[model samples]
Target: MRLQIGPNIDNGRVRLDFRKSPDRPQSTPSYEIEQTKADEFVKKYNSQEKKLFNMTMIFVAAFSMLGWITSIYKRSILWGILGIPGGVIAGLGVGAMISSNKKNNLMDKYNVKEVTKN
Candidate 1:
């Protein structure tokens, strides 16, 4: 394993290359096996995160609707009419975007498979 970090002096931007050499072993008795296991675990974790994010958004929408209903029960028509779907839509849109970006990043960073049987 090699770690290299440098700046492209001409471009004034930092570059990082933490690459395992192409000639490196595709599998090993222990270390490589552990890395593969870790990749699997990260995949599972990202999946669970996506599911939980969906569920939470559903609950938030329900809660917003419940709030609107309570307002209507109290005879506050304007807030009941405007706040419910607005909050729900905004919450879902923002949450979905943020969660999607983070999950993609996690998957990209951890899923490193270097071998395939032909």
Candidate 2:
């Protein structure tokens, strides 16, 4: 991780960066076992991705409920009718974008490439 707080005087004036030093493992892993671990990691990542997406979606739905209430309180029938669906769609769209970004970050951190399905 790297952070550039100010101007790019010397490589963007890095404020903080963390790196792990190389350390050898005590026991050497067999080829078959390493492959199994990689498979498990993918399964975990996929399951976690679905969970995060659902959480974000429910949060947006709650926000839409609040907007709907406000529209009704203001006595704007037409606006309420239009705004409800509009707000829900917008909120969900934003949520999807944020969730996707987070998922990508997780994949990058784990150095795992997502397998595309047809």
Candidate 3:
């Protein structure tokens, strides 16, 4: 198993490559298996991420709306002003943490290593 971090214009991009033997010119059957597994894993991971993103957006909107309504009801502009940043920060932070942990766990399960360049 090998993980390659792209260079130059693709910096910070991690790509998975499967090879049975570096010296061999042809790929082995196991390479196909690894590739398929990786493909499926990527598809599942992306789907879950999309769902998480949508949920986070919803949460942020709801929180912001609630804050705005509360501020109006109480006749204070502070709450309304705070809602936008508060919602965005909280929503994105929690989403990022969850996504990171989930990615790490999935990588371990799939025997994949994440490599960083520089």
For this target, which candidate reaches the highest lDDT against the unseen true structure?
A: 3
**Number of the predicted model whose TM-score against the real structure is largest:** 3
lDDT of candidate 2 at residue 97, scale 0 to 100: 81
Q: How would you encode candidate 1's per-residue C-alpha lDDT over 1-118 as one tens digit per residue?
A: 3323323322233332334577656642111112324546444644566575776687668767766777777777787786687667766766777766775565466542322221
Measured against the true structure, the TM-scores of the candidates, in listed sequence, are 0.40, 0.55, 0.57
For model 3, the stretches where C-alpha displacement exceeds 4 angstroms are 1-36
Q: Encode model 2's per-residue lDDT on 6-51: one tens digit a residue.
A: 1122322211111222453343221111232344544554567667
Q: Count the backbone clashes (under 3 Å) in each candidate.
A: 0, 0, 0
Residue 19 of model 3: what lDDT? 32
- For model 3, residues 25-113, the per-residue Cα lDDT tens digits are 45321211144355666666556767767777776777667666777787767877886677677767766777778867876776654
Against the true structure, what is every candidate's RMSD?
13.9, 16.3, 11.4
lDDT of 1 at 31: 15
User: Per-model C-alpha lDDT, please?
Assistant: 0.52, 0.53, 0.56
Q: How far in Å is the alpha carbon of 5 misplaced in model 3?
A: 12
Winner on TM-score (1 vs 3): 3
**What is candidate 2's local distance difference test score?**
0.53
**Regions of candidate 2 where Cα sits further than 4 Å from its true position:** 1-37, 113-118
Arranged by TM-score with the best first, the candidates are 3, 2, 1
Error of 1 at 41 (Å): 7.3
Lowest lDDT sum, 10 consecutive residues, model 3, at 27-36
